[model samples]
Target chain A: MRVFAALVRQGMKVMLAYQWENYMGLVGNFAFLLLFSALWSALLRGDPEAQARMLSYVFIGQLLQNWTFTPTWELAGRFRMGDVALELAKPLSLPVRVLGDFLGRNIVRVLRALPAFAAVGFLMGIRLPDWPQFGFFLLSAGLAWVINASLYVGITLISLWTTYFDQAHQILDFLEGVFSGFYVPLWYMPPALAAIATYTPFPGMFFTPAAIFSGGLQGAEALSALAVQALWAGGSLLILYGIWLGGVRKMTVMGG
Target chain B: MLHALRCYLLLVGAQARAQMQYRFNFFAQVFSMIATYMGQFIALSWLTDRFGSISGWKLEEVILFYALAILAWGFAVSLFFHLVSFEDQIREGLFDRALVRPLNPFVQLLAGQSPIAGTGQLVFSIAAFLWATGRAGVVWTPLKLLYLLGVAVGSALILGAALVTVSALGFFTRRTYTFYWSLVFPARQLVHYPLNIYSQVVQWLLTVGLPFAFINYYPAHVLLDRAADLPWPLLAYLTPLVGVVAFAAAYGLWCLGLRSYVGAGS
Candidate 1:
């Protein structure tokens, strides 16, 4: 706990030093969200039902997408730089250390995003959920962070074999953009594509949580979605641990 | 000129050969690019199906615009990858090495790094262009064909100039990535549809301000025989003219940037 806390503190300090860049990133994120909202408004100009559903989805999806935009490339770069090896030499377990770093980084991002979110809400006339659902929304967001971090860490571990892990990160980014319904709602996707999205783990990262927040899904449906998120989170963690062990063994044998 | 071109070709070939050594990585990069392109196209297709038409442009017309832009962009990226990374090269004093070469620094810098991955985008763009052109069923008049060629060349130069101009900004800021993204992200939006689909302000920005419309939209509008609010039937030919202007301006900016680039740390 003490080690994790120390790492978090260190990560926070490093992030804070680059505070201006984070501000720029926040502004960029807000601009894109506004762009999407405007696009949705244009799309749903005539249809009230679609306007309500799409506005809800867009609002919640933007928030979820922003929340889960993990810097997987940064993690992969660290591994490529052999910094991960030095990190492994520390007393902390690799996953715990990565989780601490991600949490610290996300803390800064969340703080930055909050003002933008409120501003967007005010501008777009989006109403926040009542207290109870807001509580669940926050909880689901926590789970989403865990799922996203584990998936990114797992993907980065593949860098041990593929030196061009940045390529993988790019591919993953494209998939997230398409499949997570950040660019378009899953329900609005063609029937075939939406079916595929339903089965994929991507929805757990953004779509499913966004749906829950927007009150598009509730009760049993929301529970099932959370269950899927947990499954993916657990599966990703296991895979990452396995890969880390294999990579460490290979490095040890090669005298790395 | 021929000798410079030959050297450039040889340099590009060598880079390709070197990259081919990492067969798996090269293939992976190709596949990743294909996926990215496909994803964007899919999104555009979905939008077209939902909206029927954007402003007055049909799906085929929009795809035609995208195909040309993509092809030109692909060519620029592949041919001038080092120019794209000019900021980093300047910072690391790699430009000094090029300066020592007998050839023009611009040519030498372009020859130093070729984006082999861009070949995939080029292939996809060519395929898309052929398919979209065939589907659009436009009569290939001699004038139209000449105009198309002019548009492609002009578009390539304009895009290349824009990329280089952003890269040159690194001389002042010492950080090129942000500038590159700012240019690229907005440029991607331009390729999604015709400039006419946008508001008048956006049209002016794209056509005159950024001059990106010369890359595809204006020439395409002419070829399709579509009437534009802008007068002059010969306005389509202005694409190449705009390209020359943009390239000259970019080159001038690059010279200024070079003056600012102090070899190493201060």
Candidate 2:
């Protein structure tokens, strides 16, 4: 825990150094949210029946999409530079190290997202529920972080086998863009497509939690969604551990 | 020029052979790319079903635009893969090696690295193009076929030029990929719907300013017998010409950027 804390501190320092870039990214995120709001405002102008639901879903979806997509560039670079071995040599376990780094980065993201979210809500007239719902939002967000971190670590392990990890990253981006309802609403999808998405782990990272925040899912359904998310997190961790072991065993450190 | 062409072809061939050496990985990449594209196709299909059309264009017309855009994007990705990393290369002093080479620096830089994975996108786009065109019921004349080929090539050049221009900014600002993303994200949206749906300012920005419309929308509008709002129909026919100008400008800017490049290290 101490080691993880230290690593997180280090991550925070690195993040702070890029404060300007993070500010720019925050503004960009807000801009995109505004763009979506404008498009949807144009879309639902005459259709008051679906307006609230659509706005809520779009806002939450954007939040989840922005938050859950992991930046694997640093991990990929570390692997390529053979620094991942040094990380493994540390006292901290692999998952802990990965989670610590991601958690630290996401802490910076959360801070950055706060102002952006406020600006978006102000501009788009989006209002959130009170503290109780916000608590559930926090819980679901924590799960999202875990899921994202696990997937990043798992995907980065593929670097050991192939140098073309960028292709994998692109594929992951496309999948998240689609399955996580980034561009389009999942409800608008064909029943078969939506059914497949429900079975996949992609939605648990973004759509399920987003639905909760947007009030699309509630009561027993929300609990069931959380349960599925827990299962995914556990499954991902297990798969990551397996991959890390195999990757370490097969590791060939080249070109120091 | 012939030697340059031959060398480039040989380099691409070698890249393909190298990729084939890892057959399992190659197949996995292909399958994954196909799956990724399937998601986009499904989304677009759903949107068409709900909205029927965007602006004045039908679903098939929109699909045709998407097909052309993807085809051009695939070509750029395959051919100019190295150009995409030009910023990184400059930042890391990789350009110095290219500068020392006997061949033209642009050729050397372009042919140095290849993306074998992009062949999957290229093949997929071709399939999508054929399917969309067949369904659109457009009669293909020889002239129209020539125009289509020209549009594809022009689109690739325009996109490549845009990439190069963004990459050239690395010489001035080491961290320019963020700006690149801003440009690319918006440009990606242009390939999906007709420019008329956007505000007049955006239409002007996409057409006269960025000139991306010449790559597909303008030529496509003419090809489909749609009424073009541009003053001169000859402008629509000048897709390849527009590409040449853009590429030349980008090349000139690249040279200027190279002059400013402070090579990172030995």
Candidate 3:
């Protein structure tokens, strides 16, 4: 717990250092939200239900989505600099530290996005979620973040095989953004595609949480969504752990 | 100018050769880029698939706009990708060295290479443009063909200039990624859909304030033979003019930034 707390603190410090960048990024985020919201307003046309509900979905979606933005680690650069060998020799567990660091970093990023959320809420006129809906949103969001962060960390562990791991991050972030419904509401997605995404971890990554907030999923349906998120969160971490072990063994073989 | 062009070619040749050394990583990056746009296009296809049209503009028309913007942006970024790290380049003294080099700094910097990821994006944009054109069933007359060519050239120039101006900010702000995206992306994205779909105020912002409308929307309007809501119907034909003026303005700004660099010595 202390180590996690320290990692969180470290993440907050780095985030604070680039406070101006965060502000600028949020401004960009709002501009995009406004553009999309207006377009959605037109697309929804006379459908009051979709107009009202999807606005919340789009508004809150990116904020929850960024909680797991990847490329949080520079493991390959560390390896090149001999830092990774030292890190591996350390008494601490690298995965746990990496997870803690990532959790801390994302917490700072999400907190910084609060102002954008408020602006989107006000301008787009998002319905205020009830207390129970808000609770599920938070829980689902936490699970989603775990899944996303672990996937990214696992991808970075490819440093165990190659000299670098990059250019891949852009594609990953793009695919994740689309699949998780940050760019568009999953409800509007082709039914078959949306169903497939539900079984994968991608829906839990953003759609489930935002859908709950928008009241698109409720009662038994909402509980099922939460279960999916929980299963994905644990399942992805265990799989990532297995991948990391394989990567570490390969690194040892190469004496890297 | 010809000499500069030759020098640029030589620099880019060296860059391409070095990039080719990592053939596998290069191909992997290109594949990643293809996936990136495939994902985006899928999202777009899903939206248009769900709703027949967004704000009365059909999916084919929207795809045309989207493809044009992607092509222009792909060209601009490929031309000025090192500028993506304007601050880092300045801090690392690469910008200073560019200044010292006999060759024009912008040309050299423009010649500086990006990863192979960009090639796939440009290819994808071209494919999308062709597909949209075929699906839309627009009559491609000779004059319209010429007009489309002009539009392509004009958009590339304007976007490339925008990138240069954004990069020049490293001289003053010393941090640009945030500010650059705020200015660049919103306007760039606005073009992906018809400007008419947005509110009048948003349209005014794009047209008068930022002038991004001239990049893709106006040319698209001309190509599609759609009349503008704005008073002057001739404005749609002026995209090339807008492009030339924007490039001139941005080029002048770069000179000013260069002067500042000498005075400030950062």
Candidate 4:
């Protein structure tokens, strides 16, 4: 716990040092939000009620996205630079440490994201979840983070087999966005694609929390969704554990 | 002009050679880029499925706009994408080094890096263009073919002008990544859809303010013969002209910005 806390603090320090990059990321979030909002408004034909519903859906989805953003390239980069030796030398578990760093960066992200989210939400007149729904959202969001981090750790561990995983990572990143409802809501997705998404772990990563926050799912439906998210979170972590162990064993550190 | 083209080829060729050494990396890059852009197109197609068209532009028609926009921007980016990192060039005093050289600093900055990353977008755009042409029901005449060639050149210049303009602004404010995101990129996004779907203000901005519409929308409009419906249908034929004027103005801004640059002195 102490080591994890220290690692978290270290991550925060590193992120804060490059605070301008974070600000730029927020700007990118705003750009995509604007594009999507314009797109949805055009599609919905300026129907205020429908538009407001979509605004909240997109806003909460984007806010949660920025808040829980992970460095998908971190492990790939470290492996490429042959720093895995140093990384493994530490007594603590690597995935745990990575999770700690993710948490640390997210704390700053959430802080930076909230005021912007609030201001935009207000101006856009977006719907907000009620107190009970907000509680469910926070819980579901935590599970989403676990699922996302686990998937990232697993995906980036492909660096063990190959020196460069940039292309692979990029493909997976796009797929993650598509499947997780970061690009389009699951409700709007074609039946075939949505069916495939149900079997993938990605829906737990973004859609569940966003759906909960936007009040798209409630009561029994929301509870069932949470259960599904928990299943995915646990399943991915278990799979990630095996991959991490095998990948680390296969990893050969070459000297400079 | 001949000397400048030779220097541009030499520098860009060197970077291309380096990138080719990693054969797996290059193929994977192109493959994934195709997949990413294809995914976006598929998403759009899915939306069209649900909504039955965006603003009365059918899927095939929108594909014309998308392919043209991407192709123009792809050509421009394949040449000037490195300018996206112009902030780093200035901050690291690389601009100072370029200034000391006898060659044009604009060409130097442009040719200083690899463009292999854009090959995927170019590949996808061309493929999409070929596919869209048949379904779009446009009778390709000899004149229309010539105009299409002209559109590629003109639209690329317009997109390049936008890139150079934003990069030139970096000389004034070194931390201008946010500026690119806030202004240039979103504008790029807007061109993918039919301009009519957007508000009149957005249409005017794309047509006149920044003139990004020349990169795709106006040319597509003219080719599709939707000109009769528009107030200034003639603007559809003015893309190549718009490109020359916009790029010249952007170049003027770049020169002005260059005069203001003091080295980072790091």
What TM-score would chain A of each candidate receive against the reference chain A?
A: 0.88, 0.89, 0.90, 0.92
CA deviation > 4 Å runs, candidate 4: A17-19, A46-50, A74-79, B90-97, B114-116, B176-183, B260-265
* Docking class for candidate 4: acceptable
Worst 10 residues of 4 chain A by lDDT: A46-55
**lDDT of candidate 4 over B1-266, digit per residue (tens):** 78988998999899899989988888888888888788778777778778878888888888888899889877887887777778988888877888888899988888876777689989999999888877888788999999998999999889888888888889898866656765778788878888887768768878889898888888887778787877888888898999899899989999999999988873
lDDT of 2 by residue, B121-209 (tens): 78888898888788877779998999888988888898888877877776777756665565564566555566665667766777777
Q: TM-score for each prediction?
A: 0.88, 0.88, 0.93, 0.90
lDDT to native, each model: 0.72, 0.72, 0.76, 0.82
Write one digit per residue (lDDT tens) for candidate 1, span A95-181. Answer: 777778777777776776678788877776777777776666777787777778787787787777768776776787778768877
Score candidate 2 by DockQ: 0.33
DockQ (C-alpha based) per candidate is 0.39, 0.33, 0.65, 0.47
Candidate 4, RMSD to the unseen true structure? 2.8
Stretches of candidate 2 off by over 4 Å are A20-45, A160-174, A249-256, B1-24, B115-117, B228-235
> B28-69 in candidate 1: lDDT tens per residue?
888787777777777767776777766566777778888888
**Which residue segments of model 1 deviate by more than 4 Å?**
A26-31, A52-56, A59-66, A81-85, A213-215, A218-220, A251-256, B1-7, B81-84, B194-197, B229-237
Candidate 3 stretches with Cα past 4 Å from truth are A71-82, A252-256, B114-117, B228-231, B262-266
Q: Is candidate 1 or candidate 4 better by lDDT?
A: 4
